[model samples]
Target: MSDLVIGLGGLAMMFALMVFRMPVGMAMLAAGYFGTVLISGARSANALLVTETFSAASNYSLTVIPLFILMGNIASVAGFSSRLYEAAFAWVGFLRGGLASASIIGCAAFAAVSGSSVATAVTIGKVALPEMKRFRYSDALATGAIAAGGTLGFLIPPSTGFVLYAILTEESIGQLFMAGILPGLLLTALFMAAVALVTLKDPEAGPRGEWVSISMRMRALMRALPLVTVIIVSIGGIYLGVFTPVEAAGIGAGLVILMAIGMRKLDWRMLQQAVSDTVGTTAMLYLIVIGASVLNPFLALTHVPAMLGEAMTSAGLGPYGVLLLIIIAYLVLGMFMDGLAMLVVTIPIFFPIITGLGFDPIWFGVVAVIVIEMGMITPPVGLNVFVVKSVAQDVPMATIFRGVIPFWVAMAVCLLAVIVFPQIALTIPSAMFR
Candidate 1:
C-alpha cells in the first residue's frame, strides 16, 4: 500500500474514533501514532510521539492559554460577567429588543476576558436569559442572541482560536488578535441589526425596556469597570507593543485575581475552583496541540497536503472558488465536529493550499474563525446552541436553534463582508504594526 492510502485510512480512522465518542485529542494521537508505525517502524513512531509530546507541552507561548483562561474564570467567579450585563442593560435595555442587544454587548465584553465560546455563552446566558424572560422577550430571540453572541469569545482579542491558529500557522499572535478586532465589532453590530429587524417586524416579540436614568447608567458602568479596565490594559498593551501576548495574559490574569480579592469576591474556595477549572482546560488544550504535532509529521510523510494542494490548484478553480469551497466544507464539518478539533485537523491540510494561492494568512485566520463561529450556532452539532439550551432548560432545543437563525445569517453577512473587504480584518493590525 501506498503512503497516501495509509494517510487516507488514518484520517478515516480518526473520524470514526471521534464518531464513536472517543476524545478528539486521543483519536488524533492514536491515528497519527499507528499510521506512522505502518509507514515507519514502532521505534520511529515511539520516538516521534515522545518528542512531539514534550515539544507541545513545553512550548513557551502556550502559557498564554492558561493565564487567559484563569483570568476569565476569575472574572466569572467574581461576578464580573453579571455586572457587565447590568452595565449593558443600563445603556441599551430601553430600546426595543434592547435586552437582547445588551446580551450581545455583554457577550462581546465578556469575550474580551474569556476566550472560550462555551464559557461566554454560559456566562452571559445565565445573566441575561432570566432578565429577558422577565421582560417578556421571545424565547427564540433571547436564547438565539445569547447563543450567537457567545461566538465573539473566539473572534475577539485574547481569543484561544487565534492562539491555536498562531501555533499551527506560526503567524504573529498579536497580528491575528488585531485582525479579529474590527471583524468582531462588525459581527456584533450585525447581530444587533438582526435583533432590530426581529423586533421591528414584531414589536410584541421584544417589548421596550424601561429607560434608565443617566446617573444609574453611570453607576452601572462604573461597577463593570474592573473587567473593562483589564481588557484595555492587557489587550491594549499588546497593540502598543508594551507587552508580548504571554506578558499580556499574565498581567490580565494577575489583575483579575487582585480585583476579585479586592472586591472580597475571591474566597479560598472560589480561588480553588478558578484554578482547578483553568488547569483542566489548559491540560485539554495541551493534549490537542500534542496530537496535532504528532499527526502533522505523519501527514507530511504521506505528502497529503501537497497532493491536495496540487489537485485543488489543477482543478481550474480560481482562488475565490477554492476559498468558497473550503468555507462550505467547514460549515458541513463544523456541524459534526467540535471547533477546536476541526481547526487542528484541517489547518494542516488547508493552510498550505490557502497560502499557496497568495492569500494573507492573517486575514485567513480571521475568516476561518468567523466561519467556525457560524458552526457553533449551526444545527445538529451547534455547540453554542446546546450551551444555551443548558441554560434555558425549559426552552426546547428547536426553539434555541430557531432563535440563532437570524444571528447565523448576520454571521454569514459578516463573513462575506470580511471576504469582499479584506481590510475589515487587516486594517487594525496593519496600522498597529506599521
Candidate 2:
C-alpha cells in the first residue's frame, strides 16, 4: 500500500484496538509500530523506533512535564483542594445549586494548582459530593456538576495538556498559558450558570443552605490564602516573564512543600506518595510522547496531514470551515477514545493544518485546550466521570452521566462563543506580551 493508504489503515486498526478494550498507550504503540513497519518494512521501523524512544525519553524540553506534574501532586498532598472548596462553599452555598456551584469553583481552583482531570474530579468528589447529596441535590446534578467541572484541568493555567501542547508546537509556554486564562474563566462561569439555572428551575435540585456571616466568610477566605498565593505566584511569575515555565513549576512545588509542612498536612508517607504519583503519571505521559515521536515521523513520511492541508487550502474551505471540522471530529472521537490519547494522536496531524490556516499558534493552542476540556467530561471515555464514579461508588454511573448533560450543553455554547470571538482566546496573551 502507499504511505497514505497505510496511514489510513493504521488509523482504522487503532479504532479497532480501542473497541476491543486494549489499554490506550499499548494500543498506540502497537498500531504505531505496525504502521511504521507496513509503510517502510521492519528494518526501517526498527531504526525509527530506536531513535524515537531515545529522543522522547531523553528530551530536555520534556522534563517540564514531570516537574509540573510533581508540583501538582505535591499541592494535592498539601490538602489545598479542600480548603478551596470550603472557601467557595461558604460564600456561595446559600444560593440554589450552591454546593454544586461550589464544586465547580472548587474544581476550577484545583485546576489552577493541579494538572490532572482525574485528580481534580476525585479530590472534589470526595469533598463536595456528599454535601451536595445531603442537601438533597439530585444524583444527576451533583455527580454531573463534579464530573463536568473537572474538565477545567485541561484549560487552566497549570494544565499538563497545555504544557504538552506548547512543547509539541514550539509555542511560547507563557503565552499559551496566558492565552488560556480568559477562556478558562469564561467556561467556568458558564458551568456555574448552568448549575444555577438548574437549581432556579427546580429549586428542589439544590436546597438553600444556611447563609454564612461575614466573619465566617472571612475565616474561610483566610484558610484559602495560601492556595491563592500559590496560584498567583506560579502563574503570574511565568506570564509576567519573571521566570520560565519550568522555573515556575519548581518554585510552586517548593512553596507547596513549605505550605504543606506548615499546614501539618504532609508527613513522610504523604511526601513519598506525592513523589511516587508524580513519577508514575510522568512516566505514562513520556511513554505516549515516545509513541508519538515514533508515530509522527512515520506519519510525516506519509504526508497525509500536509496533503489534507493542501486540499483544504486549494478547495477554499477558509478558516471557519476547517475550525468546524476539527470541533466536529473531536466531539465524535471523545465518545470512543481517552481524551489525552485522542489529543496526542490527532494533534500531530491537525496542528499543521491549523497553523497553516493563518491562526496564531497560541490562539489555536487555547482553542484546542477548550476542545480537550470538553472531551474530558464527555462519556464512554469521560475520564473525569470515571474518577468521580470511583470516588462516589454509591452514586450510580448513569446518574452522573445524566447530570452532566446541561453542563455539556453549556460547554457547547461556550465553545461557540470562543469560536466566534477569537479575542476571547487571544486577548490575554496579547496583553501579556504587550
Report lDDT per candidate: 0.95, 0.83
TM-score of each: 0.99, 0.95
Off by over 4 Å in 2: 314-316
Clashes of each: 0, 0
Task: Give the local distance difference test score of model 2.
Answer: 0.83
Candidate 1, pairs of clashing residues: none
Candidate 1 minimal-lDDT segment of 10 residues: 308-317
TM-score of 1: 0.99
Error at 204, model 2, angstroms: 0.4
